[model samples]
Target: MIPKLAILRRSGLLTLALGVFFLYQSLKLELGSWNEPGPGLWPLLLSLLVLTASFVLLIGNSEGGAGSEKKPFAALLRDSRLPLAAIASLVLFIVLSRYAGLTLAGGIMLLAWLRLLGKEKWTTSIVVAAGLTALCHVLFAVALQVPLPEDWLLALWSAGR
Candidate 1:
């Protein structure tokens, strides 16, 4: 294994360790039978999946590659737009949802993420945003019958209705 690729193995080992730690932590939560999954089930499964992937990444080929040095954390973050956009989206989503209601806030946030941050085509962004909004509606409003916030828009909507 090239020395550079060894970084990947070490990094993967760290991630695998963290995944294992989370998996262990998740075990403390209730793990219901397969027929009735408890809170721990999803986290445990996800952690196990992460553990598997990290292990694979750690051991995978180093033959065809230049074992490049890892970028500095600051440099990595400076080069990436997604993290900042995601954080902004969260803050904007919360504030927008407070006034606009879930549907509008969610739609706008998804649009911003897809179009601006993700650099998706307009048609694709719009479709994805609409689909996700509809999916959220179905999940929370229709299927689960969960009561959403009576934000300004929702209040006005109910008042008019």
Candidate 2:
């Protein structure tokens, strides 16, 4: 129980520290009006909420029982593979998007990630990847009229049309 409380304390402290850091960054940005919230507003509020939650956890742990058993930190770290994989996939998507354009890159990234990291079925991965690509195309290219990257492969396809 003591070990558990200690772990909780450490995690809470880390969260609180991150919250403070974000709060400081947010303070540097202009917080817009209530109706027209600026980019910093959401981050500021979220950091505050995180800080408050951390504080609550820290305080609660101080008087805790039956949570003293310490779990191995190595085990905790090892169990974080899925999150790390997801982050890696996002990084890969960003890098690939520059060369392959949004739709093709996104589709390939989603399919590979879902199939490999998520261990999803091939059919499911294909369907999901295709759906996500189409949805993103509609949202960014059609609806928002945002200009995504134009790869030579897609250009050739367009030229043939």
Candidate 3:
């Protein structure tokens, strides 16, 4: 049988650490009245939940028998490329958006990501990128009243209007 103790130990440690961190953050925030929800309420509740779960896992592990070999770290590393690339692209998008405008920056980031990570066809990438860029433009600019960076191209286009 698989070792319950090993699972419990790992899960408990993670939970305990997360619980402490959340509790610290919650204490730092203004909790306000119980009648109306405050910023600190969610984190306080989550921390309590984590603490309880960690204790349960620790107790269960003590009662269960340990079994099986540990999985290789290489197995975890195998499928990380896509996430790494996506994170890098997101960072790049943030940097580029300051100069290139949200529409252009977001469009390029989406195209590159879809093409590189998703291995999407050019037509599909173009369509998806354009659609997403347009959606963001409408949402942030029109609906949310948040102004996007005006790049040279966008500035020229707006000047003509």
In candidate 3, which residue pairs clash?
Answer: 3-67
TM-score of 3: 0.50
Q: How does candidate 3 score on lDDT?
A: 0.73
Q: Which stretches of candidate 2 lie over 4 Å from their true place?
A: 1-79
TM-score, every prediction: 0.52, 0.52, 0.50
> Sorted on lDDT, highest at the top, how do the candidates line up?
1, 2, 3
lDDT of 3 by residue, 75-98 (tens): 332333454476578779879888
All candidates: CA RMSD (Å): 7.3, 6.2, 8.3
lDDT of model 3 at position 42: 78
Q: After superposition, how far is residue 120 of candidate 1 from its true place, in Å?
A: 2.1
Count of backbone collisions in candidate 1: 0
Q: Would you give me the overall lDDT of model 2? A: 0.74
Residue-wise C-alpha lDDT for candidate 2, range 1-161, written one tens digit per residue: 44554666676677688779979999888889799999889879977987896676566556535756434432433232454465567678879878777777789889988898778999999999999988887898789998777865557767999
lDDT of 3 at 152: 59
Q: Give the higher-lDDT candidate: 1 or 2.
A: 1
- Tell me the deviation in Å of residue 47 in model 3: 17
